[model samples]
Target: MKTDDLISMLAAGNPAPPRAPSARRFALALFCGLLGALLLMACLFGVRKDLAEVAATPLFWAKVALPAALVLGALWASGRLARPGVAVGARWAAIGVPVALVWGASLVLLAALPAGDRLAQVLGTTWRTCPLNIALLSVPAFIAVLWAIRGLAPTRLRLAGAAGGLLAGALATLVYCLHCPEMAVPFWGVWYVLGMALPTFAGWLLGPRWLRW
Candidate 1:
């Protein structure tokens, strides 16, 4: 074949190279996940001693599962949005906001109810610590989780972040539970949710801008 013809054929057969995944981005996500977990655990320990013990329980595993489900759901949503050329910032907000609201509201309502109700006892214990613990640990936790998600390769970031939040929250909550003695479903439903959701929301809002490569 003529040289010109051969060049055209080669160009047609070989498509553009795929973009490489960013190592820096993945590192950022991992760092955020680890740091957030550490900070959250520290807050829980500072407020209540019993929480340290609770952190070791099987029940704690169950609690973490709930958030993991939420995270996976969010990741799936992110993937769908990406296909349509959605901005990363917008996609994070679009998916993160609703999850945070629902999670937060559920926690508030659960906490507001009377703990003496029979149903509350069967789930787990709730010990009241200063709200300050929530403020310190949960808020940061959310930020880290969001940062971790942002670092994920576009295809997996959303879902992975969500799952990471759930796992992190569950671990944090387990620690919180060690010190709490309320043992009511509603109480935990509320306070634990707040602890997990607040930080996640913060991360969602801040991570895109701060962690972006």
Candidate 2:
């Protein structure tokens, strides 16, 4: 057969059925996971005693907003990964911008403080427990996001897992803020990010096994 005629014949065959998209499933699972995390946080660690009054301040809002931003970015990337043949593109960098801005502001905040107090600022009262708490809280969301991914087709397993981990971590942090009294950005920059990193690393390590098609 002529090359052109052979190609045409091959192209004329019936196409395979398309799979349903997983974005909606991912969203619903994520919502349920977050709801469970919130309930857990509420029961285990009640909202900060001063939350009602503090809720009115910018500092309290900033704490909530930072992790919320991460949740949005991570979930967006995770949902993208749920589909095969999709490229993450430059959008990943945009996710880090908010964190960078917060880090920059944190540096400024540190610079303004006296040298003696700088260390204390970064190591807030919960220095030992903060990251652990954040990591522990992320478990529910991580499992939920993973369940979401398992039902879809993802070519980039590691990246998808990391994004799932991030979504879980961010949501967990959002809940953590309600009970955490620390307002220092440097503390968040270090411990909060580390807390998130734990799951991200776990996902990266376990992705190949769990996310395999």
Candidate 3:
């Protein structure tokens, strides 16, 4: 066959390789997160016997719910971005960076208010507590998710990394809320933002190269 004719025949006959395994990737992410949570709990339990008391509070439930919801949303968003021929960079930045910044800011603000103030009262006494909590719990989960999705052959690794970081931050915040009592808004606005946002950004920047399978 002529070379051009042969090329055309092959192109017509063959299909593209399937992208990375989505289901397996998601499963791995979830598993890694859960493992991290368990490890966090174990470590915390050893350090602070009273950690159970914090876990029993309604705030803890709120923490878990919010982050879980965010994770689900992120998974959906990530899947959409993963589609072929999309401008992954633009889509990821448009969605991921702002969401992460706003989310981190809000959490910090919520943490900083005095416990008796309506918002603060609702959230708890120690705003910084949440970031610490999240750093311990959700960071692992985020790492897991990144690891699972690392095989995708996308050019925008930085964007993917940032998205992954945001997902991790959300999950960590959720777990953090379980143990935190809430605090002044200002306290949270600064400290919490630094704690959560910095790590997330770092993760996003590093994910593409480091997390790749």
Candidate 4:
């Protein structure tokens, strides 16, 4: 067929109405998943007793802010990944910036504390179960995020998966802060981040299988 005739034929047919962009759909799905996770947190582990008074404190807000920042960065990276052939570019760097700042602050806090008490500060009382709890809390969000990206095109599957996991884990950590009593930056730098990393690791391992188009 002639090129002009083929072009004319292609333009003649009506295309289906355009639906919402993948990123918007993903955001909505993630929001629902987060709500479910929050409900799970409330049912399984209620908020801390002194939360009302402590909510205004720097320590309490610090816990929320770090994870909140990570959530924003991950969401941005994930949104880009949802679109085929789109480079995430500087978005990954944005994710690392919050993490680096939080860790740097943690080191400074540790330095300022008495040398003898540094270990206790890092280990905290809940060291053993803290990361596990965060990982468990992330399950709902992770599943929801994975579902959101299932049909979307992500050329970098592993990176996309990691971003999804990070998003889930960060959201879970935010919910976890309601029940967590630890107020130390060192604890958050080590354990809370480790909790988030577990899901990121899982996503790296599972992304190829689940995200394959």
Residue 112 C-alpha lDDT in model 2: 99
Off by over 4 Å in 1: 1-31, 43-60, 71-132, 139-141, 148-182, 200-213
Give the runs in model 4 whose Cα sits over 4 Å from its true position: 1-19
RMSD of each: 9.6, 6.0, 7.2, 5.6
lDDT of 4: 0.82
lDDT of 2 by residue, 70-185 (tens): 98888888877766656678779656986887899889999999999999999999999988898888888889898787566566899888888888888899999989999999
Q: Which ten residues in a row have the lowest lDDT in candidate 4?
A: 13-22
Model 2 misplaced stretches (Cα beyond 4 Å): 1-20
- Cα error, residue 161 of model 3, in Å, equals 0.3
Work out the TM-score per prediction.
0.44, 0.89, 0.60, 0.88
Query: Given candidate 2, what's the lDDT at residue 205?
Result: 79
User: Could you give candidate 1's per-residue lDDT for residues 1-213 as a string of tens digits?
Assistant: 134543454577732112233234334543565466556656545445465676577655445444454444444443332221234455455445645654574566566767665345434433244233544544444555444444332333333444444434544444444344543344445566666665445444543454343
Worst 10 residues of 2 by lDDT: 14-23
Q: After superposition, how far is residue 60 of candidate 1 from its true place, in Å?
A: 4.4
